[model samples]
Target: MSGMSSTQPWDVQRLPRADDKVFLITGGNAGIGYFVAEQLSGTGATVVLGSRNPAKAEVAMAAIRSRVSSARVRAVRLDLADLSSLRTAVESMEVDRLDAVVHNAGVALDAPPRRETGDGHELMFGTNHLGHFALTQWLMPLLSTAPAARIVTTGSFAAKSERLDLDDLHSRQGYRPKRAYGRSKLAQMYFGLELDRRLRAVDSTVASVVVHPGGALDSLTPSRPPVHARTTGAWLRMAPAALLVHGKHAGAWPAVRAVLDPSVRGGQLWGPRIFGLRGKPCREPVWSQLTDTSVAARLWDASCDLTGVDLGTIPG
Candidate 1:
């Protein structure tokens, strides 16, 4: 529950030291994700950047190497939009085990008449939630091998506005760009909590933690407002009060805390120290009471059904 002061500014340089562990950070080649990779790599951890774009990943890796010549780092191609790509990426890794898998990759298709993945699920839901769900399921063995493994998912405050509409999960019944994005993120959080429960029940060594960046600048920004997608443009126009809230490095803080905080509890949520929007890493309340047992369990079952993957079957 401890964190940096809410009134103070924080950056990657202030991150806790991480040593002698291996970390795989998705979307780690740019922006907040990039900085997270850089910080962990600097601390002498074996850092792998999970990137969809090879060239961009390479560039980011090169920069990190320049700063820390001994940084044991590499870039692995990973596109969460495709489940096969997720499987292939994990399969391709030569490493024996991973200490943490930071689910930092996400996307928001705001300009939408609604698109679905190859599996016929909504695009946002596929890439943001289902894909990561599958990836985590696939990586259980390697994660279980490590002394303590953490699955740190990047969620959002916008999750407050999202509900897992089981009747219309694909959002085909009513395709709203923003709503789909929120549902996808909410599902990600659901997966985090449910996965934790499953791991505990099985006495698995690995732990699952859900972290929200609160707000951040990233490639996932929607071109147009999804039903409830938060954006600077909207905040600036409709709600000036939101401007007082900052999200610049919200992604970096929660990610660092989730991966590094010894105090982080399984199934606990972390975000900025501020009013749940932005600041330093800190334990925060789950945004919705609906994210409790019934919802998380249902989402877990639905995820296993949708992705055709099961976390429970994996050996501890």
Candidate 2:
């Protein structure tokens, strides 16, 4: 697989059977997350769609059931912006083992003005990085119980242009919306890569992989009942559907591949083949900054400090 070119074919059709596996996807109620859930559930995995909104989660579950009658799926409420909510959500999970956890939920392009989460951290950074950091650490035990688990963190093309300001992780200084979003994504990638290194050092079976969904647009995503509403506006709304290169389902391919592809390895990054805007999933090169161990280690320590959670060493 390593010798294959970037355009090598990979899609939902190639996903392995997951009948005995159990997986959780944060923000699985809509967009790329929703499609990831649908595809995985269709393959017989017991999928937990973690969302902040119960109604939206139920709608996503229904959509999956409607599409795949045999889908084994459920919904759980999870608000990445709230640490209390993250804890409650983890406690409520009944599964004894988690085969994989896909960190797919996050704030997108039009993030609101710089603000703080309930924990007093910047909203974008808190929700996108700190929340997942805490959640993944808290769930480490369950993940270790599985024979071979995976932690899939969703990254973005924006990370290529952003640099992490370690001193100002909260964006206390000048905070542009796009730059903030990029910084959060870069943090996420760093966490995933750092996690893989730590897990390997401890001889753990869990793999940590980062993936980018390219440029998935809600305008191109069909809405499900009871929650999501379809794109309803003038040509401006439909313009994204027509202009964006790929659909939401296609955007999910990279994360899906990260989760299930046997050839994928720990610390690897995946994204679209065509400049990360659109195209099939492929193993993409990591940004030079993300590959720096010193930076990753610093980010890991900072995340533990900010979130007040730690995975310790891998379970024996």
Candidate 3:
């Protein structure tokens, strides 16, 4: 419920025109992130994708151009695991203002012998949480320059059930892949909320919003050739999953709405409206776990200490 006086509901196909605005999406080369970038480019905005691989980024950009005529799209080299490269990644954008940034890139390890990032931090936690934490610091100057810049963090439903064990942040003990991944995403969700609180306290023009792509499966996703293609058998095999989940294309809606929806406010959580699993995007209540100010604050401090980048100093 956006509480807007619209005869029709929000249409994923028809987004509000964001011409002249510059939007950035990390991991916009594949999966749900690709769809998010594709849909956003339709609004006539210059979409910059943050990808570690230039070749893959070019392929995704080519696919977008073929689908959407007059699409303005490009990519920058971004490797979230390496902290030292983040400043250069932000610098490569070369834009005076950033209208919005979707922190959609993440590293999810399903099974692992507990790997670590280049910085010796847990891979999932470092890339998904700390990488984004540091990236936001570098992007702050450009974000603050926009009239109403937005920081949209793409969280996960897995984050709902996890709690951070600050003592063993690197998972030196009792390391499970799923648990570690969930905690990493949980930290990201916490950061988004904490950042929103801080931004609100300062009355800054920048807004930090959080969103989750409930259950996006490739079986239900539409194809963008060369970038991705679903086989008929795979679609049939996973068709039943659609009853409870939707395609990755649909999953991009929540994050897309968070970025472009004017009615959305800072600190709000958007997700699938039906059972918080599958449906169109809607303003969902903050999960009780996510609303904990204490955890959010603690995580914020730890993130700052680890990243050596403070979000506390956003230019006025």
Candidate 4:
């Protein structure tokens, strides 16, 4: 927990020290995940970037080191699209206790010629939701070992209006890039909330918190050369949108707070403060679409079957 007073204002820039803690961020090699890693590493915590590309991961680490002096950071290869390799990846982390894990990485395809993962499931749903689901199950033991652990699922603003069609969860009957992408994120948000309920029911110390980076644009995000670069014209063109939305770094606030904020409770939803689209991080009421327990339970069971992870047996 971070700042507990409901009446007191929270400063998104100021974070509590986490020198002895260990935090893992899936896909921390780029975008919002990269900023999340950079911010946490600045806290003196050991930050492990879960990336699929070793070279890209090292580049991200180097960027962080350049930005933050004495930053404690490293990387572990993690490709959510592959299920068989997850357990091995977790073991490779070589950490006994994990204070927090930010489920921040995902895939979003713009146009469809829909793709499936190595496990033969729709790419977005498989990687965004189920991948994190399996990874969470595998990390339960380490999370349980921490005095107080957090599972920060990076949800999406797109999920606010989408409803799950559990019957055709993979969009086999029909598929649109937009709908599939929305549903995948909605599923992950559901998983995050359901996990909160499960952990509480079991009296576990591990907490699950969901966050969405409002609207973020590549043009708005700052350049960190060799990885991301934006032309001055692009930045200027997007400047008008900046009044409402943010760059990827700003989008990272809510998730960063979820890991370090003492006041943020499990099952809570956080996002940008202005119109749920832009501004500093703030707690928001759970979207009605996200509260359907019946759908959540069904998806939980289906996820267990697909990934072979028993959420019913979540540790601690």
Q: What would the per-residue lDDT of candidate 2 be over residues 72-176, giving only the tens digit for each residue?
A: 999888999998777779889888999999998998547656778889989889999999999987788899999889999998888888889999999888878
Ranking by lDDT: 4, 3, 2, 1
Model 2 spans > 4 angstroms off: 1-9, 109-112, 222-244
TM-score of 4: 0.97
RMSD of each: 5.7, 3.3, 2.0, 1.4
**Candidate 3 positional error at 272, Å:** 0.9
Best by lDDT: 4
Q: Tell me the lDDT of model 1 at 32.
A: 66
Using all chains and alpha carbons, the TM-scores for the candidates as numbered come to 0.85, 0.90, 0.97, 0.97
Q: Could you tell which candidate, 1 or 4, scores higher by TM-score?
A: 4
Clashing pairs in 1: 178-226, 178-227
lDDT of 2 at 32: 85
Ranking by TM-score: 4, 3, 2, 1
Q: What lDDT tens digits, residue by residue, belong to model 3 across residues 220-285?
A: 998889998999999999999889999999999999998888888899999998888899999899
lDDT of 1: 0.77
**lDDT (0 to 1) per candidate:** 0.77, 0.84, 0.91, 0.92
Clashes of each: 2, 0, 0, 5
